[model samples]
Target: MSDLPLRSQLAVALGRTAAKMSRLAGKGDGSVIGGRIGLRLDPELLTRLAKDRKLVLVSATNGKTTTTRLITSAMTPLGEVATNAFGANMPTGHVSALASAPSAQYGVLECDEKYVPQVLRETGASLVALMNLSRDQMDRAAEIWQLAGKWRRALAESPGTHVIANCDDPLVTWGASTASGVIWVAAGQHWREDSWCCPECGGPLDRQEGEENSDWACRQCHFRRPTPQWALHGDHVVDPHGRQIPLGGIQLPGRANRSNAAIALAVVAQFGVPPEQALPLLAQVKSVAGRYTTVEHQGRTLRLLLSKNPAGWLEAFDVLQPAPGPVALAVNAQGPDGRDTSWLWDVDYRILRGRPVFVSGERRIDLAARLEAADVQFTVVDDFEQAVMSVPPGHLDVIANYTAFQDIRTRYGRVV
Candidate 1:
């Protein structure tokens, strides 16, 4: 901060002060507000703070927060890491995070899919990690292909920054393929609905059957999944050296987290940290922004999981407790959560057919109607806490969309 120009230094100071006040007032994490204030004072605050620091920008439709948390943890042993611990992904959050830890040696920033290009250009990040891309917050964000195009153009312009990208998602591959240096990771992609057509030629994408992690190719064009230098092979991550490193006992659940861990390890390896050393650090991250937090409320154990879109819900279902365990599904069409509930139809509610289910949120009726069509039995309890209480007094899994999940976090006194 001292090295920054007078205006940027003042902006940093004011931003930190505002963030402190926000925390004291119990308003919010202070990242967003502080960032807004800082940017208003100094438009170039992010670039000024990013000077001389090795930074990594992570962007994806799903797993951005978790992957950023994992990367921060893996990089912590090297030095103090400046990161937005909360799910603040825009430029404002980036400013707040860098301002809060001005002297940190490194930064790991989680960027929203739409803001990736802008943040990438602003921060001049040395490494950009691209995970899977899917349709999310359709009413608010750009189409997946448009975002991929932006990323491709951004990387083309910034030739010095290396890219770590998921090869499974064709859109991500197409975006990162233009980078001068790219470490492609065969991070698994569960959501294929959004990437059925090749972004390169608008051709039908063909998936090779029986192949390990089925390879995708364009039926009408030359675009195809690049052979990954780092690939997630079953329970282990195959590094660039072809050495299989086990993803040992990572506290975060599901294959999605395993993919995140693999991506994190790949990112840390760029800094010369061995996968053997980083995997243990990645395992230390139990919860990311309260995504996998479990708490006891009113004699009932509630395991909270956040599923914003169909892809996220698909992964959440994999980590859910065995069938017959009461499950609560909450959703909201709030501003933060794209005001369209049509994405609910993209999820397969039939999987919850045999299980006891409860729906709650501003859009509980929409969710209930979807469940009805899927043959899932559910009770609509408008109150989130009451919905939890209505379930049997035992262990229950609660899956919610963005705002609904935040509401649960607020009710439970902010699970971190």
Candidate 2:
């Protein structure tokens, strides 16, 4: 803390005041803007806050926020964990989270995919969790392979960091493959469009018929899925010998979260928390930010799920279609959400064909067009709050991209 600049100290003070004012004005979470102003004032703020903490950095394309929450939940048995809640993966938000919990020893951070390497370089985090990689925000993100390449190089450079990586994803496997101390976890990856080939040799990965360890070996290069210390074998996350680790209170729905729990459980165990101890803590997390939170907006209640890309959309598809009521699929091409809505074209919206679909948001037209092409019937609800209410009553399912997700959540809490 002594190494911090005078300007940096003043910046954090001002940023906290602004955050309090933002909450008073009821602007929003105030995390993003407050951190933004603080970082603008003190560019080195994240480094300072990250110092002297046993940091666990979680980065992934799909499950960063929820997984970070899961990690935080599990690690509570260990001690105080400082994590950036809401959608605060950016540098500024990282700074703000640390500022809020100034004395917390365990910092569990959800680093944005693009910002992971920078955080690793600056923060000196001891444990780095690299989850699956997939296409997202094409306008802003590097090609998934490029991002994996960056991780590979970063891990190679930082040999002391213990890496927790998903072996199910070829990209993630390739990225942390060379890390000195890697605990591979079989976190499932359904989205494989971008991970079809070997990241090392660029050769087609061998998925031969009835082949053992095709999941284990790349026929072309040295790169292969390392033998995982932990894995999800069907329902239960198994042990080193393939024995089941009883997952009793996993509250988050679907296999995606189970996979997340498997990874999170493995991660905290490294931090000295046992898997059995981890589950009960992780299970208490019913919703993350607003991923699975039911928000009552304008007298209409909906369980909001954030779906940004095809992979994310796939995860929410199971949740949305199985619900008792109509499903609303909202989309937008805002800057926070990439302006390119072409990614929507790649999503399998055809699964919603039999269900009533309520499409809304800035680029609802683009989504509506995609749904139309998929033969899915949808009504374009221009007024978002009405769209939120328009869905059939009782246990409603509403899945939205980034901006639209935040819109309903903020409105539900009186923020407009």
Candidate 3:
């Protein structure tokens, strides 16, 4: 920060002042607006603050926030590290995190898929973790292939960055393949719709589906999944040539998180944090921006979870299966959650089969219709609070998308 021009320092001070006022006013976390104001004044504030810091950038269509949080924790033993706390993945969030903690020696951040290459370049990040790529925010975001192309070009330019990528997802594999040095992790990917065609050639690719050891190949263009040095086996990630390493301390359920843990461990291992040391850091993470956390609200305690797209929903549904009904699925179509709710049709609602589900949110009717088509029994309690209270209770899994999830956290989880 001492290297930054005086005007840049003033801009950051103004932004920090705005952030403090925002918190005082109970508006929300000041990361977004504060960073926006700062960037408007000093366009290069993001890159300026990133200089000389040990940086790690995490990006994915899903699981990025959780994976980034896990990676940040694994890097903690290294000392003071700045991280994005609100799951803000865009440039603004990165600016806020770096500017707010100018003295920090390291920064770990989750970057939006399309913005990953730019963030990597601006931060001159030493390590990048690429998880899986799938359809998300379909109304506004570029196609998955286009994002992959951007990553490929960006990595080609940033020859100094080492990549930690998922080997199971073809798009991620292709994107990370050209990095200077890459550590492959066989982190599992469940959604396959976007990756059926070869990224190299527009022909169909071959896929062998499995929980942890899935394989994919593109015979037309000779593109294939890299053999991973770290692979997921059942509940834990293992090195086939080495000993079994348990995916411990991670409180989040679902194999998806286990896969996330495997990728995080791989990234930190390059920094000299072995599985024994790194795994525990990740295990302490119970939630990423309230994905799997319980909070007392109204008369009952509501266990909260959030999923944005079909791929995310599938994993959240699988994790909450043992939870007692009636399940509260609050969904909305505000800008942050994507305006189009058509993706609701893509989610496997059949998993909610026998359980009683209560739909709430601005787009509750849209979700109800999708559930009806699948013959999943559900009741709509128009009031989100009433819906959560209506759950039959041994425990309840209350899942929401972006905006609605934040609303729940603000109204119910915190200040209730």
Which consecutive 10 residues in model 2 have the weakest lDDT in total? 207-216
lDDT of 2 by residue, 280-395 (tens): 89879998887887766545567888899989998887666463357877888889889999998888877776676788889988988888898988888888666656654555
10 residues in a row with least lDDT, candidate 1: 207-216
State the displacement of the C-alpha of residue 286, model 3, in Å, after optimal TM-score superposition.
1.5
User: Over 4 Å off in model 3, which ranges?
Assistant: none
Give me the candidate number with maximum TM-score: 1
Q: Write model 3 residue lDDT over 155-236, tens digit each, in one string.
A: 9999999999998898999899889998899888878877889998988888886545687888788888888899988787
TM-score of each: 0.98, 0.93, 0.96
lDDT of 1 at 170: 90
Give the backbone clash total of model 3. 2
Superposed on all Cα atoms, the candidates' RMSDs to the truth, in angstroms, are 1.2, 2.7, 1.7
Give stretches of model 2 more than 4 Å off.
1-7, 208-217, 297-300, 321-324, 385-392, 414-416
RMSD of 1: 1.2
State the lDDT of candidate 1 residue by residue for 1-416, as single tens digits.
68889998888888889988999999988999899999999998898889899999999999999999999999977999999878899999999888889899899999988887888788889999999999899998888899999999999999889999999889999999999899989888877889889899998999975433569899998998888899987789898888989986788999899899989999999997888889888989998888998888888988889999999999999998989888998999989998999999999988897898989999999999999999999889969887777876789999999899988988875667
